[model samples]
Target: MAYTTDFEKLKKQLNFKPDPTRPVSKQASKNTKMLFEYLKSIYGKKHLAGQQYLQSEEVEDLVYYHLTGKLPAVRGYDFMGVSSCKKTDDQVDRAIKWATQCGGIVTMCWHWYAPNDMDDYSKGSSFYYKTTSYDHKTCFDLCKGVTEGTAEYEFIIREIDMVSAELKRMAQLDIPVLWRPLHEANGNWFWWGNHDEQHREAYKKLWYMIFDRMENYHKLTNLIWVWNGQDKCMEVSPDTFDICGDDIYSVKEYDHSSQKQRFEYMTELAHGKMITLSECGYIPDPDEMKKDNAMWLWWLPWWREFVYKREGYKPVFDKDGYTVINKKYMTEDFMKRVMAHPDVIMREDLPWYDKDKHKLPDALSANLERIKSK
Candidate 1:
């Protein structure tokens, strides 16, 4: 059965409603809408927290500590193309299985480089950014070839196939993925960014191409596509994405107004799609987020280093002058208390992914009622 059927059915079971004036009904991908309803069912009652772990060695310890009251509600992984070629899927598979078995949400971000670039010249330069204007036409053309089925199309297909193959494998095990590829396109860091009017069109087209190819050609139904929210581009194609993801790295002074404005613009651009603070420099105080009326579906700090840095946890070097982190965060105890709040949803709080029912556990009914009462 299609995963979307279960997703839609869950929405009905929860009796979810859209913001009447700013309705996002029918605009989100089916899976995205379903997931949004699931989160919305408990919006004020609980918040889903997330974090990224770039390496496998970090996974077990991170997940264990978080579950013991030190982390967020979700686990994140990255597909960094720091090498000349793409990374292997073995690690990806391991992460998915580990997160799924523990009943936590799995989120992925791709730091994919332009296909043509190699790390031949500089000491540490990678394939993703070969030149100053890496986000220029050459990169766009490489992606466009897939749509046109040109010579470069084979390479494009190969890259996408690598991703699709994994999704297809996960589909068999009935794992759902919060897939956020080509993120932060509005910024100029990667090849997909730094676009002019023409580049903007190319970006949109590339997004459409990926969606169509993955959904239609690859037959990937498990993904809930999340589009990055940036003011740079005009609103993306309506059907191209399921959610609008915003990354807040600045706002050191806790700029609630700026945060609110960003959310408001994203909401307008989304036109009924769900909006999430997908990444943050600092975990917005839950109270602050509630006060600003900018409740994100979830937020993930950049893992151990950034999480500690943002919280002002000073790093101590060892005898050899190497930094040693015996304590990941100074606010560890404080964060434990914060996450313990009834308004925060931890991994243990999630329902089982009912294989038989093809949706969430039946307890969701009572859970919804409980949230409503709050």
Candidate 2:
């Protein structure tokens, strides 16, 4: 996710004089370019966005793009490496809408599913269950997907159905929907996280059930399914996945000689579905791959590099036949691929809630506030 290259580090790594005016394009920038192009090829733009199930009147221009953030790779656009000044969810929506106006998604997350509020309990923990009792909940379904039989999954299922209907209404407005549900289930810690010893089976079952019920009953097919999760589990069930959602956490893990052993095994199993690093935040290492411009690795947040960028940190890319994108410290050069990446988004023409970018308008803010208070 970095944009500016370190001339001094480049000099030390390549053992040459640093470029005085311009940063060296990793010297192997060509490989990075090729990898990105390949990623774009696979992401393939989706223009025929099913149906105008969502609608709104605020859209000045209509564009078709398959929104994938908050998908399997980037978690959500919130990982921009910047702590938000906006605290409330409504404010966040307003900010992301700015990005949407620029032809992108306001990809965000409703994370941390703790029920009991215990020290270690997160969203799935009993703390969360007590919270989403009457509300049409999204995170609740995610928690139910991970920990089966904690409470009434039926209630969560009903809530999902209601939300799906709402989604259908949005689609009617020609608003392309990038609906991600219970993502990163493979990454342990989340209520539905899929560690080997954790709720792996439940995770898969939940997705299958969700998909089956929604598509078969609700007929909610106007969604680009994204399966985003970290494969911390040594044994991953690719069959459990309806789509591909691969994530990377540590570049050092990629640099370690064992990275190849770890990632290569997973890639071979992923079955080559439009895959991406949903939560890229790592800096690529200055290794043979970097020499060739092979940046199929994921990116880290821009601010995470505050101390590490100057520490000779290199990214670790341990997989193959894949492209990794980083957005941290992203500059003009970084925006270049985001240039084409957004091209892969599914374009929707719906106008539902478009005035405020799919969120309730300022006028309705009070109603939502009253609902929350109740």
Candidate 3:
């Protein structure tokens, strides 16, 4: 099947125009540029299907494939391991494997635990404002943190250095990442967000600090910055970010609307940049997205429990005896329909998919046959 041919037809149908701007990183890797172009090409025509895993394992991917006979084109990861000093390398290694062995795109966000305050591995390395003693009321004094020679400054810098080293591994392997740091900052739930006017300015400064250290200082160019502050006040400089996104979790369990209102709001906030549903609970129905013209670049459903249901479903056990649920937030029948939809781009449908290089699970063939049979 010719993926490009279908893409062209969809592009013409949607009147899609490729954006001329390059990635925020002037020295972006070749893979990064290609990924960016691919994203722009599909912007108004189709959306990439994505799924997030809480850890390095492919537990969620297995469950998704079991139901839909498809794997997400984009795989999401988190940097919480670095903060917790646990299995950090495993996460990075798995991301590399997904990109090289599975022909998938990688997007990652940082759930940045407070650098100095939290004891190592406390509360399972929670980054939440309420659970930690990080004191959002006064906030970590980002001004001091950005300044040199201060304890606050050294702490954040140390944490950034640790994460940067891992990113450098991916950069060395030429893997382009959709790197989103300080996500959902519009909500007060995360320590980085919901700051007063004074702290908000400091938050922006913190963003710049990380940007400079990574892009210029560390010279890591494989990153495609995805700013997800989710509020205009927390916005970093336009050039510092390649994409803008928002996290939306619907209150109604089965709501599959295009989320047109939130999409438009993010579009306005994006300032001509590409927009995405960076994180979501329920997968948006692609048909509804087309009907409402809320074409996000991609929609990534959160980890296992968010996508799966615990009741009335037989669970598969991992090698380590961990239970993986099969019943999903969306019914199995609906999930199969969504995966089979022409507008949804799955792993094998990606333009870069090479049969020899990208090995898929053997069961996928039979699974897809079952979908066709039904």
- How well does candidate 2 match the true structure in TM-score terms? 0.45
Best by TM-score: 3
lDDT of each: 0.57, 0.35, 0.75
What's model 3's lDDT at 139? 34
Model 1 regions lying over 4 Å from their true place? 1-36, 59-71, 81-84, 117-151, 232-234, 251-258, 308-330, 353-374
lDDT of 1: 0.57
At residue 295, what lDDT does model 3 achieve? 91
Off by over 4 Å in 3: 1-20, 84-89, 115-125, 130-143, 311-328, 361-374
**Candidate 3 structure lDDT:** 0.75
Tens digits of lDDT, candidate 3, 1-374: 31111323322432223233778776888888999988888888999999887643445655677666668899898887785334454666677778877889999888776633434333343466553455432234455776676776776788888899989989998899999998888876666676578768777777877877787678897998899988777866676787998899999868889999999988877868898999998889999999999998888988757765444443355443333444546776777888889999999899879877887633344444544675
Clashes per model (N, Cα, C within 3 A): 3, 62, 0
Q: 338 in model 3: Cα distance from truth in Å?
A: 1.1
lDDT (tens digit, per residue) of candidate 2 on 1-374? 31222334422444333231221222213322342343344342321111111112111011111112211122133211111111223323332343344333323323433333222223223212223353422233344433445453544454456455654553443333344456556544455565445356666555555554554456553344445654544323333232344444554433312134334544554455443334433323324223333323332222223111222344222133111232233332433334234322222222111434433323224433543475
lDDT of 1 by residue, 117-208 (tens): 32222223332433355443123253454345454554455566667777677666666678887788776556666446665666665565
RMSD per candidate (Å) reads 10.4, 19.0, 9.7
Candidate order, TM-score descending: 3, 1, 2
TM-scores, all candidates, are 0.71, 0.45, 0.82
RMSD of 1: 10.4
lDDT of candidate 2? 0.35
